[model samples]
Target chain A: MQRATLNRMTPYAFMAPAAIVMVIALLYPLLYMVWGSFRDWNPAQTIGETEFVGFKNYITLFYDPAFRESLSVTLRFAVIVVSVEMVIGVGLALLLDRNIRGMSVLRTLFILPMMIAPVVVGLMWRYMYHPTVGTFNRWLKSIGLEGVDWLGQNALMSVIIADIWQWTPFIFILALAALQSLPRSALEAARIDGATPWQQIWHIKIPLMMPVLIVTCLLRLIDAFKVLEVILVMTEGGPGLSTEILALRISRTATEFRELGVAAAMSNYLLILLLILTAAMFAYTKIQEAREARIRAAAEEDM
Target chain B: MPTIRLDNLVKRYGAVEVLHGIDLSMEENEFTVLVGPSGCGKSTTLRMIAGLETVSDGEIYINDKPVSHLEPKERDLAMVFQDYALYPHMNVAKNMSFALRLERRPKAEIDQKVREVAEVLGLTPYLHRKPGELSGGQRQRVAMGRALTRDSATFLFDEPLSNLDAKLRGQMRAELALMRQRVHKNMIYVTHDQIEAMTLADRIVVMHGGYIQQQGTPEELFKRPVNKFVAGFLGTPPMNFLDADIVERDGTVWVTGKGFELALDGEHADAVRAHRAKQITVGIRPSDLSFDPDAANENSFELRVIVSEYIGAQSVLMCDCGGQQVVVELKSETPIPLGETLRFSVNPAGVHLFDKESENAI
Candidate 1:
């Protein structure tokens, strides 16, 4: 009986180190943030010294137009960046999924942007988007055209473009992998079945790649919401609150505004939004698996 | 139905040529099967006809019009793939009507065509089920249904029944034969299995090493194969080859081997006398050997039975003549003890002789 009990405990014994690490590295900080959100906390004072203010910070953030604007900006950025990236990335994948010479080199070149550090990407784009000395402005001048404002009035668009530039390859690589793994014979059959190239892509390739594309979109959306470094480095929420995303707002609130409690409250709101998205992603996969299981069951019943 | 012709078609991957100049034509409503071992370029030829593979040289003509540069859609053909290749996202009905929908046909017409084909393929009950929700046989039927709804002049099949289990394959093969009779169109089928080729093909083109070895009716290919490869490839249990020498003994010509000597029939004797080659290979089918105790010594082989495999009505016995292996298919009811020397007489009409050097039928 004791040996059986020990065998049952073996799995838990193996899991103890990971559980401890999770509690220390993840659970503790989350609980501390939740605990801090209710109180009027400062960076200098200990948690116990701060007076509890119970939903004051949450109420303030909820009503703040600046906070609302930042939230809207983050949503807009994520939606635009993700949609454009998905289209261009999936299109590139479809175009490049072939056995042409030097394709491996081209594929590697496409993914080069994703390999660069976000700070470096930000600095690179910042220089390229410069008013007079920048690549785009100089090229425009050389072409005898007026230089357009990339960062001044169109700061949000500029930041969104930078994010898209660095992240499109992530989607491209995944879409290419999914496209490559699709049934080759089915595509050949579709060709014989009187589908042109565009029709095949629209009807066969896109529908079959929907699952992987959906998952990639959600993952990119999650990453998009928490994006701060590049935008912060490039725009710095300058000229107004145009490019001030929620993550940048949360950081600026805690460090510059000296409002730790409000930052914690904002973090909780972001966490809630991300939690919903993560739950949706998980649910999507679960529903897909259930559907496949049901299909297998139905097929087996026929047999 | 439009007749399809491949005029000296060639396929090359870089410098390595996989399909040599292949010149063949199919009659309207004819079921031509390209059958061979794997990597023999049968599938490549079918794909070239379907316009999925580019023609390296020569031209493909459909209805006497050059179609080499035409797209698969423009070529007016439908194909059923080996893996069924049913779209996992679409239901059986949707898959069947995909071509019609792409053509922007009337919705009612598409639905009617899909329903008719579905019913014919017995896939009406599973019309709303996706490919993932169907069994292998049902998926195969859906694939066939998809091709049938297209109403293309030519239909290409790349080993369509190969992915099914043995029992299911036989069932599907019978259904296919039934369907073939119902839907008379120009069809080109590719398979590595000779049995499928023999059963379904009106004309079977046997390929070897990217070259067309022989093309004829199944009876002609089976009875009088042009070469040794086709003889050994087409039949079940395969033809047994033995090294032998042709010599004139008295007035009769005899093919003398290690453990047996067979007197050539009248027709074979004339060929043997006219032929300059002294050494030849003797070919005999397992079914041609029968136990004959009172047969002449020259006509019978005293083979030592090594293994007797009991397969229901027929027991295929593996026998040894000298050092070479010779198989005999006999009724299981025949009491043949193992390791015993038995005199099995060769049917004179079933005898096949090939030149040893060229391996060509003499």
Candidate 2:
């Protein structure tokens, strides 16, 4: 009996180190943030010295017009960026899915933007979006068109465009992988079934790729909400908070505004939103797996 | 129905030519089976006809009109792939109606056509189920149903029944034959299984190494193959080949080898006399060799039975004739002593002869 008990304990003992590291690295900081969200604290003082405030920071954020605007901006940015990127990425994948010489090189070049650090991407785009001597304005001038103010009046659109450029390749590579992995014979059959090229893509390829595209959309949405570095560097939430996203607002509230408690509460809200999205993704996958399992079981029963 | 013709069809993948100048023509409302081993260009030829693979050289003519430049949709053909290739996202009804829907046919017409096809293929009950939720046989039926709903001039099948289990394959093969009778448009089916070719084809075109070896009625091809490859490739317990020499002795042509001698008469003798080479390959089907102890040496083989596979009514006996391996299909009731020489008489009419160097029928 003792030996059996020892054998049972062996697995848990082996798992102990990982569990302990997870607590230190992930759980501890998460609990600290949650604890800090309920306190009236500032960066200047220790958490122990701060007075406990019971959801005051949350209530303030809920009613703050600036916070509401920032939330709407984040949502708009995520929605626009994700939808536009999906269309362009999937379209590019469909166009480039065929055989051509130097295709591998072309694919590698296409995904190059995604490999750059986010900070570098931000700085590069900031330079390109410059009004007087930027790449876009200079090109416009050379083309005999008047240069427009990119960062002044159209700061949100400019930031959204930059984000799309940096992240479109992520969806492009994944969509291409999914497209290539589809059954080749099915496409061939569709071709022989009197489907035009457009019909094949619309009816067969898009529908078949829906599952992968949905998961990819959800992941990009989540990442888009948490985006801060690129927008921060490009616009700095500048020209009266026109491009201030939730992540940017959170950082500013903690540092510039000197309200650590409000920032923590804002972070908690963002975390909850993300958790819901993640749960939806997981639930979608679980439903898919269960359906497939049921299908297999039903098929086996028939046999 | 339009008669489809391939005039010297060629397919090249960059530097390598996989199919070399295939010339074939199918009559309207005829079933043609392109049967061969894997990588034998049978499926490639079928795909070329279906317009799935681009024609590298030569031209395809549908009713004497050049169609090589036409797209698959414009070619008006429907194909059933080896994997069934059913749309996993669509139900059986939707899959069947996809072609009609693309044509923008009236909804009532589409529904009627889909219902008729589903009923015919016994897929009506599963019409609302996605392909992922169906059994292999049901998926195969859906594929057939999809092709049937197209109402195209030509139908192409690329080893459609190959993915099914053995028993299911046989059942589907019979169903395909039944469907072939009901839908008599031009059908070009590809498979490596000779039994499928023999059972379903009005004309069987045997391909090998990217070249068509023979194309004829199944009976004609079976009784009179043009080459050694066709003789061996088209039968169950495939034809046994033995090295032999043709010799004319006393005006009687004799095929003499290590273990047995076969006397040739009529056309075989005339062909052997006109041929230049004495060395030849002797072909005999397993079904043509029967056990008879009293048979003469000229028409019988003394084989030592090595292994007997009992398969219900018929048993296949693996035997050794001299040093070469031989297989014999015989009734299971015939008690054959193992490891001992037994006289198995050859039917004179079933003898086949081929030139040693060219491997062509003599």
Q: Share of real contacts kept by model 1?
A: 0.74
lDDT of 2 by residue, B55-86 (tens): 99999999998998988888888889989988
Candidate 1 lDDT tens digits, A1-303: 999999999999999999999999999999999999999988999999999999999999999999999999999999999999999999999999999999999999999999999999999999999999999899999999999798999889999999999999999999999999999888887888778889889989998998899889989999999999999899997659999999999999999988899999999999999899889888988998789668756864764
Q: Cα deviation in Å at residue B311, candidate 2?
A: 1.8
Q: Taking the candidates one at a time, how many backbone clashes does each contain?
A: 0, 0
Question: lDDT for every model?
Answer: 0.92, 0.91
- Deviation from native of the Cα of residue A86 in model 2, angstroms: 1.7
Error of 2 at A268 (Å): 1.3
| Candidate 1: stretches off by over 4 Å | A280-303
Cα lDDT for residue B182, model 2? 85
- CA RMSD per model (angstroms): 2.6, 3.1
Weakest lDDT window of 10 consecutive positions for candidate 1 chain B: B124-133
What's the TM-score of every candidate structure? Answer: 0.96, 0.94
Interface RMSD for candidate 2 relative to the native interface: 4.8
Docking class of 1: medium
